[model samples]
Target: MNRNDTPNGSPAAPQASFSLRQLSDADWARFGAGEIAYLRPVTVNGVHAIAIHGADGAPIGAAPNAELAVAAILQHEMAPVLLH
Candidate 1:
């Protein structure tokens, strides 16, 4: 049987899902003002890295670990959130 199919041939329940929502005008404004940042775990050259992204979805910086990444973002007066 296919991975997505149950024993009886019915489709299996989804394991996980998410919805993307567009940012509001005020959100964009805050981003432009450097008030927000997002920290996402990433892999670089086969090594783990933390990628910092601006609210506008642009890459801001990266760090070798989450602690350093959060410190960097806070030092710049921006909020950091982990993306999983």
Candidate 2:
């Protein structure tokens, strides 16, 4: 699931700051970093937890559950995607 440029998982075209076809290195590195977040189940120190990842496929934070994770993502104005 991707939000593309929108922060709510919407496919609606964004007001492009730059061309999508020829993304530069810096833009590619920050791909989706601001618009989307995702959740992955993980165990931290033997305790089950949900890991939050940015659109760039990097870990940003963690939450104990999906509900709180979603809330946190929303609070930060980023769309959340749940990974199975």
In the predicted model 2, the residue pairs found to clash are: none
List runs of model 2 lying over 4 Å from the truth. 1-29
After the best TM-score superposition of candidate 1, give how far the Cα of residue 41 lies from its true spot, in angstroms: 0.5
- Residues 1-84, model 1: lDDT tens digits: 998999999999997564325767676556545777888999988999999988778898999999999999999988788888
TM-score of 2: 0.62
Candidate 2 scores a C-alpha RMSD against the true structure in Å of 9.7
Of candidate 1, the 10-residue stretch with the lowest lDDT total is 16-25
| lDDT of model number 1 | 0.84
Alpha carbon lDDT at 51, candidate 2: 96
Q: How many pairs of residues in model 2 come into backbone collision?
A: 0
Best by TM-score: 2
TM-score of each: 0.62, 0.62
Q: What lDDT tens digits, residue by residue, belong to model 2 across residues 1-84?
A: 565645766687657785687988777878777999989999888999999999888889999988999999999999999877
